[model samples]
Target: MIIELDMSSDTPIYVQLRNQIVKGIGKGEIQPGEKLPTVRQLAADAGVNTMTVNKTYQILKNEGYIRTDRRLGAFVSENINMNAEFRDKLESELELLSAEASITGMNREDFLKLCDEVYSKMKSSPIQIST
Candidate 1:
């Protein structure tokens, strides 16, 4: 999987790396037991300090999304939570999204209506997994 960093973003590089990794995992591109590139390698690719990659890896480890082995390196972890913590985190993310939407002049009702429409369409669409 490839990830690109935007130096222009206000968010810190480590946070951006962590967020992108999470997104890759969520999109099913990165699977459990998948080995991540070395921290130095990722940092070089991202054009950031090795410390940034280490920091991001630490966050992912704390979140139970990945674990590092001395010789094997970092790998995607199993046994994740599908509970209140996730719901709360998702809500926090939605709040930021809503704020951005509001800034772009999307009213609450319009946002809700749009959400319903999207949900309806999503419900109608079936996911097809490739073998």
Candidate 2:
């Protein structure tokens, strides 16, 4: 997967890198246990500093999205846990986004449809919605 960074955007380079990697994993572009490029290699490829790449990897590791081994380097985590911390984080983010959508004149149905569309695109299996 190609890592694209917007230099002019307000988002930090490391955050952008982290988000892209997370999205790649969600989209199944990067498989579980798949090896990722080394920090030096990714830094060179992304035209960022090694420290920035290192920071991104550290964040991913803390989030349980990736794991690192001294001998084999970093790879995607075989199992991702959707524990309380992640759920809380997800809830907080969605609450903010939902408020933004409401303020921007999006109705409940439209907002939910948009959410479903994006979610469906990311998951390989069919989505089951419960009322």
TM-scores of all predicted structures? 0.74, 0.93
lDDT (10s digit) by residue, model 2, range 2-92? 9999999999999999999999998989988999999999999999999999999999999888999989999999877777778788899
Single out the weakest 10-residue window by summed lDDT for candidate 1.
122-131
Error of 1 at 37 (Å): 0.5
TM-score of candidate 1 versus the correct structure, residues matched by position: 0.74
Write out the backbone clash pairs for model 2.
none
For candidate 1, what is the lDDT? 0.82
In TM-score terms, which candidate is top?
2
Which pairs clash in model 1? Answer: none
RMSD, one per candidate, in order: 6.1, 3.6
Identify the leading candidate in terms of lDDT.
2
Give the alpha-carbon lDDT of every model: 0.82, 0.92
lDDT of 1 by residue, 22-128 (tens): 87776667877899999999988888999999999999998778999989899988545555666688799889989988999999999889878755543232333
